[model samples]
Each structure stands twice: as C-alpha cells, then as structure tokens.
Target: MRRAISRLKPLWLVPILLGALLGVLGVLDVVPDFVAAVPPPVIVTAIALGVVLFAVHPRAEAHQPHRMAAPVRGRWAALNTPGQQLPSHGSRFLGQYAAVDILRPTTPATPAKLRKAWRNSTPQEYPSFGEAVYAMAPGVVTATWSRSRDHRARNTWQSLVFMLVLEGSLRSVAGRAALLGNHVIVRHADGTAAVYAHLRRGGVAVQKGQQVGVGNQLGEVGNTGNSSEPHLHVHLMDRANPNAAAGLKMTWTDITRSEEIEPSLAEIAKQPEPNAVLSMPRNGEIFEA
Candidate 1:
C-alpha cells in the first residue's frame, strides 16, 4: 500500500481540503445571505498569509549563503549580503564568537523575519574585507561603544520577534540605541561621519578621540544591538549621532560596476568568491578621494 501511494502526485489534496473548509463554513451558516455580499476578511487574511509563508518560507531551495564555504582566510567569519559574501576573516566568532542586513533584504529564513523595503548592497569589491572599507579620507574616532556581550543566534531571533511585535507600538523615538547598537562613529577629514554598526562585544580596537588610518581594525564583528546577522553596516552621514544623522553618498575605488535600480538578493549572494572583484558607479563618477 505504501508503494502504491508513492506513485501518486497527491495534487487532489488541495481541492479536498479547500472543499472541506467551504463545507464547514456553509454548515455554520456564517454567510447564509448573499454569500458574497460581505468581504470575509478572515478567509482573505488566511489565504494571503499562506501565500506569503509559502513564498518566503525557508526551504532547501531558498538562498542561504551562511552554509556555504568560508570565503575568507583568518578565523573571523564574514558578513552575508544578498548575492555575495564578505569575508569576516573566517571568524565563527559571530555565532559562538561574535558579528552582525540591509533595509531589509527580506530574510526568508522564517516568516517572522523582518522584511526589507530597500537594501544597500554596494560591495567594496576586493580580494578580502581588508581591501577596502576605507577610512573615509581619514578622521578621528570621536566616540566609541564596546563591551556588550555577543548575543547568541537564539537571542538574535528573540530580539527580532520582540521588535516585530512592537514594530508599530511606538509613536516616535526621542533617543533610541536600537538604531545603532555598539558602534564607532569616526569623523573624516572632510567632517563626514562614517557609522559602523553591530560590532563585536568588547572588540572595539580603537579609542575615543584616536586618529586612525583607513584600514585600521576598529573591532571584531558581533551581533550586538538591533541587527539580524553578522556583517558590518557602514553608511556615511553628516552627523555623528545615529538618531540625528542622514546617510551620505559614499563611493569606493578599484571595483567593478553593475548598477541596478533595485538589486536582487540572487546577485548579492554570488559575491566573495576567491578573486571576485566588482566596482560601482561605472566610470567618470568622481567621489571623495
């Protein structure tokens, strides 16, 4: 009997279940009048949720670069982007050790994961993470925050669930550290501030008011603050504070170009291969040197 059923496609189960649900609804007399006169928000919501859960649900076919081979050398693990992987120096320090997506790359790992409305996936395009992530034309570390314990992956998920639960509960924020948890804000020579968020706990290698070069190691990556995974979140802003700052226009040197209005996750997952290099903005676009 088991062997006999194995040959069947089992496509009829869907209609059978749907039919049973409708039959139960009819017997309950919930929609005795007009049948279609009123909108069934419950049924509509269930169907919509089912579709979304099916699409974003984590499965074997879903994109997951974390399970891929460690792309970089060293013991530090790298941050993951949509299509590409940035070497964090092979550090498992993020999960057991420490580390830290975009506006929302739309993590399909689970239904409760945050949905990214937009993401900034501009790869620095070098052999390793050390190649770029520059000093932003030189600056001093005006302020730094270290010493937070690296939240385990389980904790990360718990924090995400809490935030999603309270997503619309807050009216506005007067001051919230959740925006930039455990980070360093360096003021560039041109007065532009580069904010690096979700760094490793007690891994900040720099000090307050210390002048450092472009390639100086500030700290190990960690899952601190409001972050989903282990990756350096760098975005230029005019102000030093995360709450009051607006992201600035940033550019890099010696990279390949593939500009998209809205780049897909498939493209970001392909990065970090050995010797894979890419540049942004094409040619002739002069950025702050």
Candidate 2:
C-alpha cells in the first residue's frame, strides 16, 4: 500500500477525490435536486480520467543489470529512478519511457530555500550545468534538435501547477525541440536510440549520421527545454523518432558507491566512484565515473 501511494503524483489524486466526494454528496443529499443529474456524469468522467492517469502514469520497471559505457565522466548522481519513481508518466511512443536525470554530485539537489524563490536562477549555479554528455553506446547520429530556451528553474508552486496542467502539450506546441531541449538522438548499437537531452547552447559536438563510439562527447548539459535545472535527460527508445517509439529498458555499467548514499545522506563531499559497474543509482545515491 505504501509503495503504491508513492508512485502516484499529487495532481492525479485530485480527480479521484472529486469522484468519490461527489458520490458521497449524492448519497447524503448534500447537493440540490437539479444537480441530481450531475453525479453520474461527473463520476463517470472522473473514473475515465482516473483510468487514463493510471495508464499514463510513469512506469516503474524491474531493474535489470544493464551494462553500458558510462555516458559522462567524473562523479555524478541519479535523480528520479526507474526503481520506484516513474521518470515520466507518458508511456506511449516517446512517453512509455523510463527517463533519468544525471547531474554532478556537487550540484544542489534541491532548491536551497523555498522551491519557488529559485525560479529566476541561472543554470550555471549548478555544478552539472556545464558537464559534457557522452554517448551511452556506439551508434550513428540519427537526429538532433536545439531550439528551446533555458528559462529559469521552475521551482515555484505556480510553475509546478502550470507544468502539471499544461506541460503535456509543450512538445506539440513547440515541436520536438520543446520538451527535451537541445537533444541528440543516436542510433545505439543495441537496436535503440539514445536521446541526450537538455544540453547547453552550442554544446552538441556530433552531427547527424556521424558514427560515434561509447563515451564520445555529445554535448555539455544545460538548462534547456522543459528542464527546471541543468542536467542530462536520457532514455532509450526503439526508434529514431521518440514520438513514434516505445521506451526500452536500460541498465548502467561501471557504477559504484562510497560511504554515503543519496544527496541528503551525507554531504557527498567527493567525486563519483572511480570504478564503474552495472547497477542502478537510487534517488540520492552518488556514483563516480
């Protein structure tokens, strides 16, 4: 029961509560008689919405020991895990993916103060803001995009609410360039494409159709697209076009840990673990490449 609740997003809970509340009100005669016709439709709509939300909810995948070359050098940590947190809720096409954000271990994991006060901050404030992104696997460059603006970090309640309500349509409104921001798609050797997203302006170093080896420089991480801070957003898709592809499972190689785990456990006062191995880094766990 605890685990299930953890998987649910707060915004998704609203409609569910509304549906149940309407049912209770109808039973208690809390509403007007003219409103008698309201409960059934409202209840049904809420149920439908509930099903959609559940269906679209980010997927928590069973961790497989995936071994891939380290995509970035130096010490870094993982946020939004495939272990419990569904990185992104959309699970169809580019949506059915387990996305992970990689940032340097030295960066601020959360807003230093109120979540909203940092809304106008710059990406350079974070350590991972300028770190270079590397190829997850050897493959040819399939596609690239770099048009989104790296607006201030959306740490305010207002921006969070707005993102919950309308962020879904950002990709459609701004084209594929909107959500991922300055991303590159490499046709990975394992029959999937590695999407390197949220890169800095002019950070991309490889071109489309160019062959790259594992660990090749793709670009420096930046605050672009739908990102709230600077970090590398990556996911594996079955096809070159994320919109038409399904997300594939990925396992990291060459991962190791130290005395501390997670950002809050201990001040990760050092770099990532030097010897990389195959494992999943939990939300706060740090790893060095």
Candidate 3:
C-alpha cells in the first residue's frame, strides 16, 4: 500500500476538483450566502495545498546509475546530459532527471553548417533522422507507440521561445504520449525500465511483450513530440509507467571514444577519456560506442 501510494502523483487534483465543484454550484445558484463567503478561505487553502504538494513530491535518486550499452551507433553528440547536471531536463518530473539527447553531427563539422542544419533543415536532411535506435540492454518490451508525426525543428531562438512558452505547455497538459511522441518502453528483469523517445512515425520494429537484447533495433530516430530537432532521447527509470516513475542515472558500457566538441556551444565540466570502458558523455561531447 505504501509503495502504491508512492507511485501516485501528488494530490494537486483535490484542490482543482474542489474549485470546479464550487464554480458549478455558483453557476447553478445553489450556493447559499454563507457558502458564497466560503470561496475566499477555500481558495487560500487550495493555494497552500498546492505549495505543499510541490515541496513534497517524490524525486529521483541520483546515486543509482544504471549502466547499459549505448543506444545508438557511430558518431553522436550529447545534449541535456546528466554528466553536466542533475535533473538534466531542468526537472525531475516525467523520469527525465538523468535523460540524454543525442544526434549525429553534420559533416565538415562547421559552425555555419551546424547552425544552418539546426535552424532550417528538414527532418530527412539531418544525419540522425531515420537512424536505427537500439535497445540498451536485454529487456521485455512493455510499451510501444509510433503514430505521432515528426514536427519541424525548434533550434532557432525564435522557434525555441515559442516551443518553451506555448507548445511545451500544451504537450505537458496532453500527457506523456504527446510529449514523448512515438516511443518504446522496455522493462529489464531487475525491474528498471528504459525509454526510447522521439522515434520515427511507423518506424517501431518491435511490439509489447517481445524480448530484446542489447543493440537490437527498436526504431529510427525522428523529430517528433516535444523535440527541438531530430534526435534520440534516452532515459532510465524506476518503472515502465513514466507518469509515476523516477529517473535513474544512466551510463554507456561500450563507449570507445569521447571527444569534447565546440566548448562554446555548451560547457563541459570534466573531460572523459577517449576510450573509457563505461562512460556518460557530457554535453558538447562527441562520442562513439
């Protein structure tokens, strides 16, 4: 019972339902004068409850790093990496505490080309788009989705502002499926799960209940859901249900090369060895596994 309770989201809904009920009663003219006077105190109490819920919400354990194989092959650059900060996506909600985004760098590796690709390229023009996404470890598929259409890139300042202010808000309200786009959830025998998000529409190659080994292809990367561009989003979680799961630290067991690229783009705290056996590439780092 305690475990189940911990898995549940915070009780913010209680105040929301109360507010809605009071509004309905007011519209129906069923609220008495005494009850009409009750709204002020009720609103105050609701605000306090919201504050308490936010303070006490369960957060991911940072020390529990889950080691697995790299989910993609060849050259890739890391972004929003936990190696740079905890709650990598700026929040622990939705099991993204230690999530990472990766994309293939453009050829010639020029700043001009990178900016142009990010600001104006279509999904198919990016190297990472349609590239195979692999299972990080042996697991049974618990969920699969492949219907969300790949949207345009939001890498430019103007588009990013719109995404963060408007589209992101709507996606959050629409829930995990809308935020993650075409995705797959795989649960390992130890109970931890891995999520592969922003997959290409109609690209999912596996179904729920199927077993997958490390390096097995699950789908191709795409610029879907609440993404800024065509990149693969990977994260580990305590469970398969992302709504309740807490994020877990993740590392790659087969990283063969790690190179820091364009430190001006994003800061890099520590330089990982070129051939570290097990590693988590920091932001601005290009790595091969």
Candidate No. with top lDDT: 3
Give the residue spans of candidate 3 off by over 4 A: 1-6, 10-57, 60-64, 108-120, 262-278
Backbone clash pairs for candidate 3 read: none
> How much lDDT does each candidate structure score?
0.40, 0.65, 0.76
Error of 3 at 74 (Å): 0.4
Q: What lDDT score is found at residue 255 in candidate 2?
A: 61
Ranking by lDDT: 3, 2, 1
> Candidate 3, after superposition: displacement of residue 161 in Å?
1.1
The C-alpha stretches of model 2 lying farther than 4 A from their native spots are 1-66, 85-96, 106-113, 116-119, 168-174, 264-278
What is the model-wide C-alpha lDDT for candidate 3?
0.76
Higher-ranked by TM-score: 2 or 3: 3
Best-fitting candidate, scored by TM-score: 3
* 1-289: candidate 3 lDDT, tens digit per residue: 3224434434554565566677789799897787677659768788567544533324654364677999998888887787666667777666777889888876553223235333555677677889999999999999998889988777566677788799897676455778999999999988989999999998899999999998999999998898877889999888888767777887887876556573434545454334221357777778887
lDDT of 2 by residue, 151-256 (tens): 6665577776676677745443344577778989999666677788889887888888899998889888998887766788888766676644556657776666
Backbone clash pairs in model 3 (N, Cα, C under 3 Å; residues 3+ apart or in different chains), count: 0
